[model samples]
Target: MTALIEAESVKRYYSNASWLQRLLFLGGSEIQAVDGVTLRIEKGEIVGLVGESGCGKTTLGWLLAGLEQPTEGAVRFKGRSLGNIDAETRKKVQLLFQYPRESLNPRHNVRTILSYPIRKMGHTATADITARIHSLLEAVGLSARYADRYSFQLSGGELQRVALARTLALEPEFIVCDEPTSAVDMNVKVQILKLLSDISREKGISLLFISHDLSAVRFIADRICVMYLGKIVEQAPAQQLFDHPCHPYTMALLDAIADIDPNAIRKASLHGQPPSPMAPPAGCRFHPRCAYTEQVGTICWERGPALQPLSTDHLVRCFLYPEVSQDPDRKQ
Candidate 1:
């Protein structure tokens, strides 16, 4: 398939201070929400972006979806710079935020909420808009009757269904789904994940699914990218990464998840909060929290390791991986 979106060395930094602080002439550091990250999504694919909270997954999503501008670097859609694309062209990419309740407007019913985006884009007339709304509701497994209910009246799952419907109402070619299942119940989460998977296959829509839920990603993604401190630490096919994780951070994340059997050995190998991104460690951002990192590692501390390609597709950024660390030319 063709490339739908590409983020070339993307970096999005936000001021640490509030607007009031800046107005008062306060001095504050910057939060590197997305720092020097490069990624690509192909047409008709689901790429899972997994990381801890504040690891730049959502920020990168917004950049890809054209919702947030990158402080540095560029995002390209179908080989066209995102900055150059007009609103109408950019709407081909959509962002599905984490919280459905917060995403919806309380005053509007589902019908009005779904109709507005289609109307704003001027895609359909009054007669076709209502039919489109009904189909969207049904596509998400929600009945057409729920269209008249306000957001507050619906359950979390129902509300999320409405949110998905709203995003689909636009019939976007690509979607950046930020923790779409994070706020839903366990059963509902599975249902939603399955629904998304089905939709991607049925509609040939590309998606960048961002979440900390590794298990969910393992189930739903074609490829997985692990992020840490605003950088992509590893990129591999889901099962391969799980089967032979090269990076220490990736290994730790695998261990963090509870397997099917409750009797399986469970342990938390990584400790200490990630160091502040505003003042990240000079070398590998994950070095401080890596249990495998030892005192003899000067390269891991003095200089940042490059992203090494273990195979044609699998990539890791760690000094321990001699392929990347020993040879500087290898790039993923």
Candidate 2:
């Protein structure tokens, strides 16, 4: 399978505001929002990215969507490097933000919002924009009557559908969905997730679905990537990941979910907030909070682990599997 999107050692950093404040008083430090991270998504497949708040999931999504550029490394789409692509090619990869209310223009009606992208693309005639809007409205489970409605006139779910319609207007081959259903009601969230799945199946569009909701990811993703700090600690088939999570961080996350079966024994919860990305912990970024840290050693503190294959499809970055390590002395 060909990768529709790939990120190689991507990194994004933000200098602390204290630098400015330092002019008045000495204090504060910089922040590394997204550190070295790499991932890939095959065509027509959905890959879910999950982590706690401020874990750089949204930043990774934006990078994949081309809304933001990486400070280091490269992002490639459809066999072509993103940096080499023209604007026309870039439009084929779209991003859907989390907050529909903030993403949509309050003053613009639904029709205008949907038609804006169509017109900008120069792909349709002005006379046909209204018809296209109606078709899109229906495609996303919205009523044609809402075409003339303003952003505030509709409910949260309705606004999200409108946003989806606008994204569809571009006819993108790949989409980075950043927490698409997080702000909506549970019923609406289910509808939105089903709608996304249906659209992906029907259109063969590849998706990088970013969310902190593990349960939702289980339902929609073919594969899962568990991120910690600024790095991916585990990647595996969705079912395999949930059933036999290899990374300690991944297991901690599943344990933290409240709805797990009562008969199943729970793993210990991850304690303490993740360390600052600016100076991420040495070896394993997750070692500090991991209950399985007993298996890690000084090497996990002095050197970072590379992603290594566990099973045919599962890949994890941890010293627990020393057989995959490059160091002969460390090889199990």
Steric collisions counted per model: 0, 1
- Cα RMSDs of all predictions? 3.0, 3.4
Q: What is the lDDT of candidate 2?
A: 0.85
TM-score of each: 0.91, 0.91
lDDT of each: 0.87, 0.85
What tens-digit string does per-residue lDDT give for candidate 2 at 119-139? 876847866888888888999
- Give Cα distance to truth, residue 293, candidate 1, Å: 1.7
lDDT of 2 at 180: 91
lDDT of 1 by residue, 203-282 (tens): 99998999999989999999999999999999998889989988888888999776789777654367989888898888
Total clashes, candidate 2? Answer: 1
Candidate no. 2 TM-score: 0.91
Error of 2 at 99 (Å): 0.6
